[model samples]
Target: MARETWGTRIGFILAAVGSAIGLGNIWRFPFQVSQEGGAAFMVMYLAFIILIGFPAMLAEFVVGRKTELNTVGAIRDFAGGYWQYLGGLFVFIGFVILSYYSVIGGWVLRYILGSVTGGYAATESAAAYFGMVATGTDTLIAHAVFMLLVIGIVALGIQQGIELGVKVMVPAILAIFGILAVYAFTLPGAGEAYAYYLSPDIGYIMQNWQSLVPAAAGQGFFTLSLGMGVMITYASYLGDDKNLGIDGISIVVLNTSVSILTGLVVFPILFSAGVDPATSGPGAIFVSIAEAVLDLPFGRVVGLLFFLTVAIAALSSAISLIEVVVSYAIDEFGMDRVKATVIAGVAIFILGVPVTMNTVFINLYDILAAQILLVLGGVLLMVLVSWLHAGEAIEELEQGIGDLGSIGSLWIWMVRVPVILVLLVSLYLGVTGYIDFLTGAFAEYLGTL
Candidate 1:
């Protein structure tokens, strides 16, 4: 079967960026930067992006473009039977990720409605708001509804599913975020938030070096939708005419900018409301930022805008993840888009059952995603690009990027050696207990009592 292709280069870039600029950027970056020390981590993270993330991304791109294959096929062609399983593994992880991911997107959708109805405005307490979000049967139902919307979009095929979806969603996400940041900066404690985010803390950096290094790198790769087959899948539709390196750099810049901007908005609200940085947990934005919103001079408008923007950002990524599974299914198996989407949706809904039933599922998912899928996937990609298609990779990277092409050699080395070592070290830290895995504040509060 001939593979489907994206109609326009811009469409492909937008779709790829949609997958990259997601919950990782907005949902996690704030709490992470707040705990890890802001600008220090950001600086290291940018270095990782250029040194490791960009190269891994191009590795995925070359495999996709040369083979015109999805994650599964791309691996099979290069590495034969042994490695193809790894690629299938990536596709499966993307599927597993989308399931629970959309559930969080459901939280965003719920909050968007809450904002419109002023439900969030009446709440004074973070715990109460977070409680209202969780432990409610309604939340699960909302997740189901959100999943169906994602399925519907994926059923539309590329031009409609990914292309048009991102086109509208990306602009909306940026516009709302820009407005929210402006309003946030005007808040009384806004400068404090900026300091909290921008000021370097060498003590924190040194103490958390082992733990934070892996995290920053993982997020750098994950934030840009690299390491996973999502980038490979998106770039398969990429034409040889455009400069892949330039396009990759643009996406990385845009994704990183949004992540930083989200931190600018979130931490200020957090600092302004005097929320405990250590305790914000997985739902920190909802808790800390929600509390921050209620304290604003125009609290209603601010909270409404904040939650709605999060919803849009979350939805855009969810749609792209769904499309990754949907596209591979239709193209590889010769199924119709609708049949592919429905099966993919149903399978994911079942997989997400763990996320709904177990609180530990969230941690398990995050840990496994980083250690197993993300690290392993990235390592495999580097090997394929540098070892398997070394010559072609050099040529493709040089084609569009001009003088910048020379850095391509260094990128390959970093992605192949340093990147894997860092990921392995981080995975070991989690497994061996070099540091405690403290994600929320409840434990500290409990200790006080």
Candidate 2:
């Protein structure tokens, strides 16, 4: 059987951008910036996206185009030794992400229901409702339902299903998010939200440079879907019909715009409503933001739109994640996409139970999976492309890159040695103390009352 290619280059770009623009960009990005250093945090995050995220993206393109296999097979065929370990790392990271991501996807479904049902009218009532959703079996059922939707789509195969799915959802997501952002701009205290968001605290970041490094890098990596097999898989479907260089920049721009707009909608509402944006840990994005939205005029209707858009973004991204693991199964085990999808989805569903049942565990899983693995993945990708396969990879990357020589030896080498070690050490600290610091604060907040 031959591998599937995307129907159109535009369809492929939209799907790739959809995969990149997930709830992490919306909820996670804003909250992380607020916690790290606000405007200063945004500066670092943007910098990393350009430096690390863009190159890693081209590297994945090199691997996918060269091997025409999924992550597992790519590494196995390419390195022929420990290279397959890289692919295994890809599979592992995707599986871990799916476990918790679908749980949040469920929350999106619940909020979708609320939009129609007026789920949150009064500020106080909205807070209580959020608590119920966060700590309820309701979330479990929603997670299962969302996972099923993802599996059903992947079961339809890549061209007939995944590409078509993103083509529809990505546009709707943008439309709805645009409407919500317009509405947000009209709200009382929206200006304060803008002020709170735009005002960069350089002093805070300078004093806390240690914490900002990994926080900004990890968030940047996850936001662009770099340092993951998603980019590799998306690139594997690419044809030479379009300029890879131009399309790569477009995807990054679209993803970054949605993330920035998400902040526009969220932080303003939080500042106006007096809810601490950082109060809920990683979960804070949903819980705290929902609480703030409940206080706006016709707040329930707004909450409905917010969560519904969130659900769409989450589901779209979740599909790519499941595909990453399932593609490995199909590529290596000869399992059909349907069986592969079911096997991976069901397995992750069971593993996700811990995160679902225990809110604390769910938060911990979100932090560690993203903070440690994401940065680690990005660093390794930089080393591999910038050095391990530099001579060959750069050639492939530069085919349409215009001038390959401009990247310079020192420039590429920078990502290979110092940059790699820095991200690795950041990963180590993020997995240990930082987890305790962030989660512990979150747990303390949850424990109150």
Distance from true position, residue 278, model 1, in Å? 3.0
User: lDDT per residue, candidate 1, 194-232, as tens digits?
Assistant: 876777777877777876777776677778887668887
Tens digits of lDDT, candidate 2, 269-331: 787788776564656776776677666777777787888788888878888888889888988
Off by over 4 Å in 2: 122-124, 400-403, 408-411, 417-422, 432-449
Per-candidate TM-score against the hidden true structure: 0.92, 0.92
Clashing pairs in 2: 115-304
lDDT of each: 0.74, 0.77
The collision pairs in model 1 are 279-441
